[model samples]
Target chain A: MMTLLFILFATSMWLGWHGKRKPAIFVFLVTIALCAFWFKHHATSELHIDL
Target chain B: MTPTFARKLNVIFLIMICIPLIGAYTIQFGRGEFPCPLCLLQRLAMLGIACGAMMNVRYGIRASHYGMCMISAVLGACISTRQILLHIVPEPGNTGYGSAVMGMHLYTWALLIFIATILILGVVFLFDSQFESKEATSKTRSVPALGAVAFWLAFGITVANVCTTFLECGFKQCPENPTSYLML
Candidate 1:
């Protein structure tokens, strides 16, 4: 799941580099979607005990 | 007020972000220490900041661009702060997860960077000199050669992270306290 986030960031950077303004913004939005998912996942999940 | 100065600042911060990311890669690959999920999230935030700064460098300065940087910094800070609080045990001997850098844990360093980013953003906003003016509207802005290099460097780092993360997690939840590469 985290791998997907980095991929989105890379894509956004590449698009921004090429002056694809709107597409870069869209890519960032996708990255934000992943962020929201992760935040929810972490907040709701219980920490597993090692013992 | 000059666009050139704004562009230069963006490039400078972009390079600044690259430095820490390089160190992170070195620690991960060179020292063979894998980053946990939260650490990876911090990396994502840093890369996101670089992306915004790179956009400012590539294009002319825009308020929305700085907004992007601000958003990323806040998110990074939240993640790092959460990690820090999790390890704040009453017990005296708890060293927390992962190794420390220069006597401070890496997540602590990440929190510092995020705070620094907010401070920098605040300072940059106070000037407002970078905003495009009516008279300066006639001027044309071109992306600097160095900015292009920084962009590619950031992109490469992000891609490398993607590869490393995929190897570690493989479409599964990354270990909370990752010690070794799952694929390894």
Candidate 2:
């Protein structure tokens, strides 16, 4: 899963370098979505802080 | 600052960003301390932050690119903050996870770096000169060689990460507290 995320980053860079701005940005957005997912997944431990 | 100089600064920024990743790598291998899952996420966010600057270098200085970078930094800050809170009150003699530099763990330093990146990018946005037409800006931004190197360095590290991460975790989830490379 972690490796796949890094691959997406590399693909985004490759697409951007080749001048495919739209596709690069598109992949970047996907990257962002996945990052949010991973963050949620890993931060599952309950925080004990009070409001 | 001129658009060209801004691009140069973006290049320089990319180089600066690589420092922490390099340090992380050194510690991972040198100290034989594997990165936990949260550590990998922090690294991922760092790469995401780099992607924004990378877009500026490749396409031109667009606010959206910096926006992307800041977005990543925000995510990174949250992740680091999570780790810090988890270890906020470690058991007696626990200190914290991994090694400490300057009396703080890497995640604490990561939090600082993320905040700094956001603030620095925000300040850079004030120039408002780099947002000119994309074509005109790209045409004027002729010093692509250095910018290209910086972009590739970050990109190359990402690629290297893919390899190392696979070695460390394979297709399974990375260990919560990794002690050794899983595949090795």
Candidate 3:
């Protein structure tokens, strides 16, 4: 999961540096979506823990 | 907006980020309260954005804008990650010290506000292109250098505090239960 996040983050950083606004935004949005999905899945399962 | 107006807006943004941080600290030290994992993440994110905004205001928009956006994006990711972590892994072993607030209801509100602020900043950065203006860009490079220094200083102090708190009370000594409500 961390690796996926790092990849997304690195992609966004690359897009930003290259002045590719749309791609950067897309990457950020994708990161947010993945995070939300994982969070929901974790929250519903028995292993889910709230801090 | 004129350069002057942009500068003012940058300052305003910085203050927006700082006020809550100071309030959070007061609540933590003065009120003897501790923040949870999500809360700590939010504080860290806010600090990053505040530093970026402060530098933009002090220098110029062109130099600091990309850096600010990057910082905002990083912060947004951190806060979002913390929230997900809390919801998915609520066990004692997964928790960190000073990650849970001991008393008062306002901390939750603060957390929500902090998260929203980071997200908004990230979105703003996504659409902003003013920083790329050739004339303004050259004048703004120095801003980020100074901002980076300040960011490290603030981050250093925050880490030191967290370290001290962790040493004083291991994770086992802190609250095991999660907050009953979700701020988001």
Candidate 4:
């Protein structure tokens, strides 16, 4: 998961560096999607552990 | 935007990312405190914000870049709030997972950073008065050498985090309550 995150960050970095506005925005949205997925995957288990 | 104001915003974004990263490493290496799964997620969110800031610094100030910061901050805040709620009313002698700093846990600090990020972005959006000229939009001011330094700093931190996270979790899920550094 961390690897995937890093890949996204690096891709975003590259896209933004080249002034590719639309692709950069796309990457950022993908990041948010990944965040949501990871949060849901972990949060449920954490809730079970804590409660 | 005026070049001066844009520069200031870039610096602010850099500092916003740097401080939390430095603290995170200090707590991890200095105190031998391993981050749990949620803590790792919060760190990722921080990196996400830094990436957005780096974009603004390296490319040019854009609303979309700040939007990246806002989205990541929201994710981070949610993660920290959940962790805080988990231990709000702990059992006897639980004493929480990681050590507290300045009378508050690290998660609390992360929560504060996330909130601050949101507020700062809000203000930036409200008073976007720096963007006052067509020239400012057409020929955006390039980042100075120092901005390159800031960009590298964020990149290095992100890489370090990736390494540490891989060590902690590899391809499998990280444990909720980690007891020690998992180096496999």
- Best lDDT goes to which candidate? 2
What DockQ does each listed candidate score? 0.45, 0.66, 0.07, 0.44
Q: Model 2, chain A: how large is the TM-score? A: 0.89
Which prediction has the highest TM-score against the true structure? 2
Query: Compared with the true structure, what per-residue lDDT tens digits does model 1 show for residues B7-61?
Result: 8989989989888889888888787788888888889889888988987887778
Question: Relative to the true structure, how large is the alpha-carbon lDDT of every model?
Answer: 0.81, 0.85, 0.49, 0.76
TM-score of 3: 0.47
Clashing pairs in 3: A49-B90, A50-B90, B35-B99, B35-B100, B36-B99, B36-B100, B37-B99
Off by over 4 Å in 1: A44-51, B90-93, B133-141
Give lDDT tens digits, candidate 1, residues A1-51: 898898889889878777687788789877966885786577544433443
lDDT of 1 at B178: 79
> What is candidate 2's lDDT per residue for A1-51, written digit by digit as tens?
888999999998888777777787789889878988988988888865664
Candidate 4, CAPRI quality class derived from DockQ: acceptable
Better of 2 and 4 by lDDT: 2
What C-alpha RMSD separates each model from the true structure?
Answer: 3.8, 1.8, 10.0, 3.0
Give the higher-DockQ candidate: 1 or 2: 2
TM-score of chain B, candidate 2?
A: 0.93
Q: Per-residue lDDT for B52-100 in model 2, tens only?
A: 8887887778878888898889999989999998888778875678999
Q: Which pairs clash inside model 2?
A: none
Choose 1 or 2, whichever is better by lDDT.
2
Q: Report the Cα lDDT for residue B8, model 2.
A: 80
